[model samples]
Target: MTTSPLSWLPLPSSTDRAEDEPASESDDQALDPVQLAALHRGRDAGEAAAAWVRSLSGRQENEDHALALEHAAAGIERASHQEVIPGGEGQLAEELRYALGADVLLGATHTGTVPDLAAGERMPLVAVCALAAAMPSCVLGDLPRELTLLAAELDAATAAGRAATTATGLAG
Candidate 1:
């Protein structure tokens, strides 16, 4: 018999047959280690974001902030289930840079105009933004804008607080 061009490759044995079969939908739903890690990170980030917002004056009793945090958490959970496309390295890099910048700006609110917080302190923000970035633009409608506004408000409030504290110190 003439040798086939594919003959050089070893064929799957009986035991390996199962590995070649397509996974069912239920099987696909099961998260691998990386997905599980992302989910946990998202949960932690949601908690951090909620706590940070609550720590702001008058925000602890704001129902709107609570609702926004809930929405963000839900979005992160949905985004976590999305599959990463192969050969999108450039897109991924851009997403990561954007996420980092967004998170750093948010983190600056906690550090009083300087994004010099420890990595651990900023990680949750980065994780949240990174997951948010992975979501499709159609699904992510309004979120980035909302987050930008929130960040601006928080940063302005922080700067004001710093100025007040400095004036009080100088006067005393």
Candidate 2:
């Protein structure tokens, strides 16, 4: 019999544990402040975007596009639940950053400036763009079609934002 290299690793038991069994205390102790904050922000952003997408899906001019958006929203919601696993917080943060950027662009395009967004509410959107700018160049071809479209949309928004700031003499 051949043994796989991963066979030595501990596997989770399929048997159910008693309800009285104590949970591991290490779970809460594992995360640092930054990671915890990222997880929270990612969860909140995912929930808000999912709700927004659900509402937007109802008003779509194209049924196919609406369906795609609904699926995307569900995927985002599922990713949000990954916070309990190791390294899942970072994954959620990255996914929400791209998703939120696309959401911001869509909302801004459909409706003019959202004057109602509080600073806290607006922070994730701003952070998405800022992080994108700081990161290495993206190869859109490597991403899935949906994400490619979202990235393109965000790129256009970045250009528009720059132009608006320049026109307002806010660019230094």
Candidate 3:
């Protein structure tokens, strides 16, 4: 079996994973690992965003994706680079945000099969912030302090994931 070197990142707690949710190969088709990490990292962002939205009178309980979520994420990120991400997030947009973010969280939370960078590797904070800036929301996005907090949380989550995997010696 070709193990990804990313195994060091902690697998999400059972509480974090949606059990009773059927497996949908969905975005598994187009994913190449990096995007997945981004989605995994982004999941926390989504949760945070959802809380923010709820405070603003929005309520949404997320659904497990039934199809192509990661490919959609990469496509959307690509689109953002190609053109200016538009302003305003409607309900559809929030859902899309959740999907992409969840995948990023999945991606960011693990990285084991590689024989390349060892277990403790992390995507730099600057890169994380850059990615966040590219999100469709910056125009109406929270202030700098809030953005910084998000980046810090991502760093912490990634570190926690890595620590979990390393502690088990199954990371690499």
Expressed as tens digits, the lDDT of each residue in 1-172 for candidate 1 is 1211111222443132254655433342433454333333333333344344223312223344334334433433333223121111213234334333453334324434433332333444444445444432311334234333433433343344334434444211
Question: Once superposed on the true structure, which residue ranges of model 2 sit more than 4 Å away at CA?
Answer: 1-29, 80-85, 88-172
- Alpha-carbon TM-score of each model against the true structure: 0.26, 0.35, 0.30
Q: Indicate the worst ten consecutive residues by lDDT in candidate 2.
A: 1-10
Worst 10 residues of 1 by lDDT: 1-10
Q: Give candidate 1 misplaced runs (Cα > 4 Å).
A: 1-59, 82-123, 135-172
Instruction: Give the residue spans of candidate 3 off by over 4 A.
Output: 1-138
**Highest TM-score, which number?**
2
lDDT digits (tens) for residues 51-169 of candidate 2: 54454455555555455446545644544423223322223345545543555424434443332222332343353343333221121222223233333443443344444444554
Candidate 2 RMSD to the correct structure: 14.0
What lDDT tens digits, residue by residue, belong to model 3 across residues 10-66? 365524325454444331334345444443444445344332222212111122221
Report how far off residue 89 is in candidate 1 (Å). 14
Ordered by TM-score, highest first, the candidates read 2, 3, 1
